[model samples]
Target: MSDAAAYACDNVSTPVEAVQAVLARDDLTPAQKQEIAQGFSARGLEFDVSEQVCVDQG
Candidate 1:
């Protein structure tokens, strides 16, 4: 999935929300999840549930 799509899936939600959404589905594999997480992290897009801000926001 594209970053925009991932963001869309995770829109207005937390990293946990994105992770959960990715986890709940069967389409992506564990490697895919890790890849997604890594991609987000590398781009500084991790989510904060409490703050409602992407890591890049700071």
Candidate 2:
């Protein structure tokens, strides 16, 4: 991995943060995002996508 990628991997504290980082990228399509999200789901990781949970926080 590149230095930046290695640094990010080292510093990331949770699976949800890594998943959110991937989801936030503009390059991924809906299908790709869903596939990745499903993988996280299998591992019991997720973002609270509800407006009350996410909208006010950011």
| Model 1, TM vs. native | 0.35
Worst 10 residues of 2 by lDDT: 44-53
lDDT of 1 by residue, 1-58 (tens): 9999888777645665666576556687656766766665634456222212347755
Model 2, 1-58: lDDT tens digits are 8999888677756766778888777787767877777777743345432112335655
Clashing pairs in 2: none
User: Candidate 1 — which pairs collide?
Assistant: none
Q: Compare the candidates by lDDT and give the number of the best one.
A: 2
CA-only RMSD, every prediction = 13.5, 9.1
